[model samples]
Target chain A: MERILAILVKDRSGVLTRVSGLFSRRGYNIQNIAVGRTVEPGVSRMTVTVDADPLTVEQIVKQLNKLIDVLKVSDLTDEPAVERELILVKVKAEPGRRSEIQQMADTFRAKIIDLSPDSMIIELTGSEQKLQAFLTMMQEFGIKEIACTGKISLLRGSKVTCDMKI
Target chain B: MRLTGAQMVLACLEAENVEVIFGFPGGAVLTLYDEIYKKGFKHILARHEQGAAHAADGYARASGKPGVVIATSGPGATNIVTGIATAYMDSVPLIAITGQVATPLIGSDAFQEADITGITLPITKNNYLVKDINELPFILKEAFHVANTGRKGPVLIDLPKDLQAQEGEFYYPETVEISSYKPVYEGHAGQIAKAADAIKKARRPLLYAGGGVISSGAHEELLQLSKMMSIPATLTMNGLGGVPYDYEYFLGMPGMHGTYAANNAINESDLLIAVGVRFDDRVTGKLEDFAPRAEIIHIDIDPAEIGKNISVQIPIVGDCKLVLKELLRRLQPVEKTNAKKWCANVLEWKTSKPLHYSQEPGDYLKPQFVIEEFYRLTEGNAIVATDVGQHQMWAVQYYRSQKPRTLISSGGLGTMGFGLPAAIGAQVAFPEKQVICFAGDGSFQMNSQELATAVHYNIPVKIAIINNKYLGMVRQWQELFYGSRYAHTSLDGSPDFVKLAEAYGAKGLRVAKAEETAATIKKALEIPGPVVIDFQVDPEENVLPMVPPGTSIVEMIGGE
Candidate 1:
């Protein structure tokens, strides 16, 4: 199963390399990860999606907590949460299939953000489930290229009061 | 302030309030040692690298601070492997530094080109391979921080020769930001509640305390839990004296060679509240039959430690001190009821005299007599370090270690020849207190070269060698398991230890009779230059209270 973990860590040099290196060294496959500074400066929050089992995820969480700069980390699966992902795809739209591709993209609610005479750039944002459905539908449009920002999450309907200092 | 790597090392040492470091001179570390000489920091040059490592370990154990050790590259670096591994197993905070080949020649297998980082990894909590002097102060700062924190194990820094030679605009960071390592501090409320509920429900509860309790300084919390809930407590050898040995609820050290009282209580416990212990094989004889009737509640600071060995009903992963506080909080409203019947049941299993050496008017000295007399002389206040063997067991069984962190021994690793140098380290760490060492003849032979180090430093450490002809533990195993085959445990030929000590310019004494131990020890302590007393103990005697491998914890055979 693919699982995503949201980690809050003190932002510093080598922190990203250390965290990623740990995953690689342990041979725990990481599908993708999105990291950026949070509203609280000097603290970076990362969402790591890993192709691992529940036990392996647990082991990873425990091991990650052992590192020095990690402040507060939680695997969001066990609790109520909201998760989202974004994907941008550019597809070829030949005259023979231009109308067909636009109709297909419109069906998936993927806005044709940019359109030229021969191709369309489509942007989609939704829950991972909806995004997967849209991506599955877009496969019929003769896809040219795609880029995705992995899952980002927040606890559902509640504010997270994170007070840990590095 | 601008400084060199060597000067930064001094500053780092100053930050940690380090008083002395144990090391030996070599070409690579010459500049660093020269810096030490000019800066006026106390550094004792040991005869061998292992001796320096052990001395550092002893100092750390005695002072409750990380011990610092320095050595040059190649053979010198390799020499401390056993010592590092010993500290790793026993959780001693030793910041060890090794001079490596210059950064440019690191992987080329240059002269004295040992892969120090790779070589030392298995023995260290963590290691750093520094290629630049700019990172030196920061690394050293981090080294001290990491070495002295989070489980408190040895950390190594392999400093290359060029890195040491180069100067840097170095400043020590007040703190480091290591993003990957975040240790848990507070115990979860839910887990604490579950633990309290276990205590409330169980009829026979045992609080199994380990070294981590002492390390966390959780004695008061442990005392509260034991008294408030009427939980009987048993300590591992490392956990001895965490609670007063005289407490009604206190059972002695538990394990293979555990006291009858301790093993019996462990067997009878309905709820085993293991606090800060790893539950090593020594404690749990056979996995299946151990704690046969109990629901194990393993409360450890490390999450990975939970359920690593014994299955647990409640696994509380948090600091021992915090966990104990939460436990006390949970039990406040609960009424206290003494497990009087259960305590009495464990008491019935105790022997009249737990450690009695023969007073049958024999001339041959007994190892027990030396420790028993040592205990009497010091009143259990003096710190003791021992190498592995029958002598180490006798030190634990005989010496009443009333103070926390007083009894230092190589427990899990059981490294022979650890005593004398460790005692020197302990004495250096605590100059006001008396430090004693118990060494078996075989174990003494391993690091006896440090005797010269002791004399050179003029550290007042009392050394007592239990001079049996053979390696006592191996011989005991041979007797019991291999039909007394006695393959090669004995030291067939060796120099007389008394004569050897005399040659090293230290006071020496040889005891032939059991009656002579107290006087010999007293005289040794009184004399100035690192006294050595060779006790000619009986060769055939064994460290009894042996629980055969794969047997139940309660089924140990003890000496009457």
Candidate 2:
């Protein structure tokens, strides 16, 4: 099962290495990870997607909580939440196929962020499913280069995760 | 008052009420040593950095306080790596202070500079590299707090020379406020209730205890719970001293090298209350087959340890002492007849396959006999530290510990050269109590230099070297698994341990005959200074009740 874990950790040097080192050392398969500054000044939030069984996932959470810098860990997989991933894909496009590519981008609400004579870069931000579908469609035109920002997520409603008393 | 970083270090240590420090002086740590001398904190200078770390660890284990050790950078810092890892593996509370190069020269690889924090990341519970002088006091305070609190382990603080020399305002915090590090002490009522109900209903129940029972000072609670429900108890290697060895309900140690009764009981029990045990591979021969019929109730302070090794039926995440107390309070007192049948069966196994070795008036001394004599001579009142090897297992099997915190050994890392330094620390911690180190010939040589430290301090720690003339444990494994090839296991060029002891200004005795074992031990014990007694034992003897690798605990080969 694929599980998403939101981890809040102190903003200190080498903390990222420490957290990632733990995952690698324990043989936990990290599918994707996105790290960014949190609302607090000296804290960072990391969203990690891992493929493991329920027991293994629980072990990972507990291990993450053991790290001194890791402030909070939550399994967002079962929670009602909104998740998004961004991708910038450069697709080979000739003059004749450009129109079709533009129409497809428009349908997916994606934007042509960059363009060249033989290729066009399309930027898309959406749920992982939407991003995967758009990538599959672009693969038809030969994706020359690709980059992705791993999924980041937020819970729905007023279920605040950051403001919980530490 | 303005103070140097070194002064702040001492101030924070004093604030934490640290009475003694085990450390060695080096160029990088000169300023800190100067401050230590000026402030007059009792410091024992170890012969090696590793000895310093192990000594501190032994002090902590004996006194239930965080052990303190200081070392210089580069080689000095790296030397303590083994000790740090040993302490980390055993969950011994230790605070290691290392002096680093000047801040500006940190990344440049200046003289005597090593990234001590980076080197110790995996081994330490937590570590800090002090970059600013102002953070010195807080870092020191936090180091001790992190070391001594919840699932205690070693913590390191790397102090740069420049920072140690720089003056700063030092303020030791009255209380640490680490938001993420609040350890859960009290067990959840719901989990405690479930545990209690399981105990109430269990017919064939066994209590599997570990070092956490000793670390949390919960021996009394464990005894009460076992007595209340008549549950036979078994201990892990680290858990040996938690319950008195001769306790009626105690089933002895379990897993590899475990007694037949303990292993058989674990296999047959329906309910296993595993407290503070990590279910190590040595303790669980084959995980899939370990305690096959048992529904495990794992009570541990670290949530990470609850289900990491085995599938726990009931998990209580809290301190062992607190959880055991809660379980005791919530549990209903049952009649002794409840587990009478099960106890009878366990006792039968115990009496039928009791631990035994040949004593047919041999020429050579038997290590087991030496340990037995030591136990008899000490009357089970001494603190026994041991190095990792056959002697370690024999010490655990033969020498009975009557109280908690008395049997200190390097269980997790199985580091050699731990016994002497650890005994030194134990002696320093309790000067009136007798401290003895049971070391193997291969193990004693690893840090035999510590004899000098003991002699200089007049620590009076007795060291019994089981001189088997081989790396006994590995030789046994080779003998069993590799057709007795004995590759690189022989200590052919070992030093004369007695001469080495005398060279260090300590008393030394050599016992070659079996009949002289008791008298030799008596003489060594009567010595006022540090004493090393070398007992030449059978070289080929192996630890019995052996569960081979990848085999089930029930499949034992040797004992009886």
Candidate 3:
């Protein structure tokens, strides 16, 4: 099963290394991860997706919480949360296939971010499933290059993950 | 007052009430050493960085204070890696300060430059690279705080050369406020109630105590709990002193080289109250077969350790002292009449296949006999440290440690060179107490250079080298599993340890015969300074009552 963990950690040097090192050392496979500064100063939030069983995922969260730099760890996998992933993909565009690709992008509500003589860059921001579907559809048009900002998530309502007192 | 970073380090140490530091000086830490010299804290110069680190660990284990060690950059920092890992494995509280190259030259490959924090990240509980001079005091405080609290492991502080020389305001915090690093000292009430209920209902309950009982000073609580419940208790190597060996409820250590009674009792237990013990492979020979009929309740300070190896039925995450006290408080004293049958059965097993060795007249000295003589002479009052090997097993088997913190050995890491330096540190911590190192010939040579350090400091430590002329443990393994092919386990050419001790200005003795063992040990004890005794025992002797690897604990051999 895939589990989503939201971790808030002290913004210090080598913290990322520590987290990643722990993942590798413990053999936890990280599917995707996104890290950014949180509202609290000197604190950063990381949303990591890992493929593991509930027992292993619980162990992972417990181990993460053990790190001194890590403040709080929440398993948001089963929570009511809004998850998003942003992807920019450059697709090959011939004179005839340009309208076809634009029509496909329009159906997915993606916008054209950049254009060149031979390629068109489409930008899409949505849930992981929608992005995966869009990428699958664009594969026939020849995906020249693709870049993705891995999944970042938040609770649906007023349940803030980082509001806990340290 | 404003002070240099080095001065702030000294101030932090003094504020922490650190009486002595084990260290080796180098170019990167010259300023810190100068400050230490000026401030005049007792510092013992170790021959090697590893020796210094192990000594610090020994001091911490023996004195219940965080041991401190200092070293220079690059090689010096790397040399302490084994010591740091050893402490980490055993959960010893240690503060290791290593010098780094100048801040500007940190990544420029300058002389003696090493990314020590990066190198030690996996081994240390926490570490810091102090780039800013002003953060030195806070970093030092945090280092001590992290090292001494919770699970208690080694913490490192990398002091760059330039930062040590830079000026900073010296304000030592009276209290460290690490919000995320709080350890749960109190067990949950519901969990404690559940454990007590299980204990009450259990017909064959066993208390499996580990190092945490000793580390938390919960020996009295453990004894009280055992007596109140009339529960039989078995100890791990680290938990040796948690209950006196003479205690009726006490079973000997349980594991690979454990007693037949302890192993059989564990095999037949119904409720296992495991406290502060991580079920290491040596303890549980075959995980599936271990305590098969028992419902296990694990109490540990580290939550990750619970259910890590064996499936724990009820997990309590708290300090052993606190949890045991709570359990004792919550439960009513039970009648021991119901447990009388179980105790009688355990006693039958104990007496049926007791730990025994034969020593005929005009025979060579047996290592077990030597340990027994030492125990009889010292009355089990000395702090005994052992290097990893058969001698260590013998020491654990024969020497009955009656007090907490009296037996300090490298149980987790099993480092060969740990005993001598650790003894030096223990002696330094408690100058009035007798400190003895039960070392093997193969293990003694690893850090034998520390003999000079002991002599120089006038540490009255005694080294009892069990000279079997082979890596006895490995030889035993080879003999059992590999058709007696000794391979490279033979120590054919080793130093003359007695002469070596004499060369370092210490008393030396050699006992080649069984009759001479008692007199030699007494003679060595009478020496006012460090003494080394070489006991040339039979090389073929092996630790008996062995559970062949991967077998159940009940499947022990050589007991009869």
Query: Each model's DockQ?
Result: 0.21, 0.74, 0.70
Error of 1 at A30 (Å): 15
Summarize candidate 2's per-residue lDDT along B52-131 as a digit string, tens digits: 99999999989989899999999999999999999999999999999999888889979888888888888899999998
lDDT of each: 0.82, 0.92, 0.92
lDDT of 3 by residue, B1-560 (tens): 89998888888888999999999999999999999888788999999999999999999999999999999999999999999999999999999999999888889999988888998888899999998887888889899988988999999999999888899888899889998999999999999999999999998999999999998988999999999888899999999999998898888999899998889889999999999899999999998999999999999999989877888899999999999999999878877665778888988888888899988888778999999999999988999999999999999999988888989899998999999999999999999998999999999999999999999989999999999999999999999999999899999889899899999999889999999988888888888999999999988998998999999999988855
lDDT of 1 at A150: 83
Question: Can you tell me the CAPRI class of model 1?
Answer: incorrect
Model 2 CA deviation exceeding 4 Å by range: A91-104, A116-120, A133-144
Ranking by TM-score: 3, 2, 1
By lDDT rank, best first, the candidates go: 3, 2, 1
Those runs of model 3 whose alpha carbons end farther than 4 Å from true positions after fitting are none
Docking class of 3: medium
In candidate 1, how many Å is residue B62 off? 1.0
Worst 10 residues of 2 chain B by lDDT: B358-367
CA RMSD, predictions in order:
6.8, 1.9, 1.5
> Residue-wise lDDT of candidate 1 within B1-560, one digit each (tens)?
77877787888898878899999878778878888999999898889999999999988887788899999999889998889998988788999999888888878988887877677655676688787788888788888877877677898898887777678887778888665555677888898899888888887888999888877888788888888877778888788777876677777788888787778778878999998898899888987888888988888878867765666889988889999998888775444344667656766665452545574576567778778899888887789999988898888888877777888888879889788888889888888788889998999999999989888878888888988889889999999989999999988897799899999998889998887777777888778668888888888988878888888876776634
TM-score of 2: 0.96
lDDT of 3 at B105: 89
lDDT of 3 at B125: 96
